[model samples]
Target chain A: MNTLKDKATFKQAFIDTLPVMSGYLIMGAGFGMVMNSYGYPPYLSTLMAVCIYAGAMQYVGANLLFTGVSLFSVALTTFIVNARHIFYGLTMLEQYKKAGKEKPYLYFGLTDETYTLLSRPLSVKNKRAYRFYVTILNHSYWIAGCTLGALLGSAFPQVRGADFALTALFVVALVQSLEFHKRNDLPALIGAGATLLSLLIFGKDNFLLPAMGVIVALLLLLPEKEAKA
Target chain B: MTTHTYLAIAMIALVTALLRFLPALLFSRMERTPRFVIRLGQDLPKAALGMLVVYCLKDLDFTSLQGYLPATVACVLAVFSYATKKSSLFSVLLSTIAYMLIMNLFF
Candidate 1:
């Protein structure tokens, strides 16, 4: 009886995550290609995709690795880039309590897409099994994408400006963020302004760290009015 | 050198997992999330993404068309495509392909 139920849960999980499958495949491939063009091997991309698993951070991390940044810088950048996951975890606190042994992995796999899916009221009977399958399946899609992309990138390493995909990715993220949190232009403006200022004052050679610092400080200092819930 | 790369990857993975784990840990021990942390989480992402976009474009040289044109056009396309279509894959794929085409064909 349990096995039959589990099988049904797995099927539902697969269907639920189909949309993420497509998104992860392409975005993961873009990250893999960027890593390959920067001279990293395909296996390394796979390793990062499996371990780090965060989309934007992996792209930024590839660039940081290419430039040979220090480990402290890597840690700092990872925290700043992925801080949004904090909110994801908070929201999942109750839903994941019943997750039992799967709770840790559930927390680890709480990505933007997965969070969106899970946060929606569940229709499945076995929420725990469904969540686990969704997380694992989405992860597999990302790994597949990263591996395929790396292989393709190695085959055609001469694809110039493949790195620009990272820029385009961030642009998409920025626009999405704006739409998600309507009337967020002020913070966005502050972010851009701080970065440009840091870029000029600190110089291109070493601007990211200061820009990050300034952005955090300004945001903390000037809080926006909380939206009515 | 390879060891360094692996070590950096490990550090990044650790930090990232830690951020994902933070709220879980705190909430498990407490009743609710503090207002400060919630506010930071709510506001930080948009600004961070904005900063990242500028970081990505930091190398654009304004002195020549070849240096900045492809990036500028692709970014504009990315913004408009995402705004109208609301499909991340379509917007990213289109802009990236357009950037590559302009770079390869014209320059």
Candidate 2:
């Protein structure tokens, strides 16, 4: 039956989300450790992860929460900081349209990792089914990691420095992006330059938004040679 | 804990989810999206990522700069290694270990 096939496809999609889940576990655990160190209960941290599901933003939120920052300020910051998700959603419109009933879940599941996985030209029987499966699978992984971290926070008090893992992951992602594009350091240069300029001009707290704004503006305005496969 | 903290967390989560989920849900219903929306999507992710990288490195103090210097070197080394068609894992591992050693020695 069609329903049976859909179930099977969804199961496979979950299976395909394993890689992303692994990454999320490590990062989420790091977040848990940091939150515990800051005297927040692990359950709170886990809840934040489950609900917000934005990694860096959650980390930033934890700090802001500790300081008793206003909700308005946090909301404003998140909008400015994550404004890029708007673009991410835009790019996926065409792909997501063909997703049918699986569309809602696909939209919710589209994290950076999921996006990367979906964007790749991988083998799949049903692209929409696989996409939805991958998205749900990745979300489950993140939620699982967050819950595990919360439970482990108290018993294993001294969580080591795991923040570096995120940086390492990004470094790996940058390398992969480079390899994918066959480019010679342009992306890295732009990233570093924008970051440095933003830091100098905007201070630590506000640098990211303006820097990103500059980079996106520049990339959009400048014309590039068409990519050749 | 104050009620304000709890409320703040809830609000943050709500806003984030709305931004993330609404567009995908609403836009998919339409047969055709406007040109501006399409253009916005194309440019947004990279810009956001650029911002995130800056956000992470924003707290780099001069004193800690020395600690991160080796990481910078490792990044360059990794790029060259990648250029030579080496495995990405190998390049990242090599640089990470190098960074750790340098950090331990200096800091």
Candidate 1 lDDT (Cα, whole model)? 0.77
In the order shown, the candidates' DockQ scores are: 0.46, 0.36
Report, to 2 decimal places, the DockQ of model 1: 0.46
Give the clashing residue pairs of candidate 2, or none. Answer: A87-B41
Worst 10 residues of 1 chain B by lDDT: B36-45
Superposed model 1: Cα runs more than 4 Å off: A1-45, A54-103, A106-142, A145-153, A156-166, A179-183, A204-206, A223-229, B1-12, B23-28, B82-90
Worst 10 residues of 1 chain A by lDDT: A177-186
Candidate 2 lDDT tens digits, B3-100: 88798888778777677676776776677887555654544444444444445545555576674576567557766776676554455555555655
- Tens-digit lDDT track for model 1 on A1-229? 2122498889888876665675677778888899989988899999998998988799999988888889999998887777757656766776777677778888998776676556545778878888888888888988898888898974533567765655676677677666444445667777788889988998875676677677767777875666642
Model 1 TM: 0.62
Runs of candidate 2 exceeding 4 Å displacement:
A1-23, A37-41, A64-69, A116-126, A154-162, A179-195, A224-229, B1-3, B22-30, B36-62, B85-107
Question: Can you give the lDDT of residue B10 in candidate 2?
Answer: 87
**True-structure lDDT of candidate 2:** 0.63
Clashing pairs in 1: none
List each model's interface RMSD: 5.2, 4.0
Model 1 / residue B40 / CA error / Å:
1.5
- Candidate 1 per-residue lDDT over residues B34-107, each given as its tens digit: 66655555555566666767877888999999989999999999999988998766887788889989999999
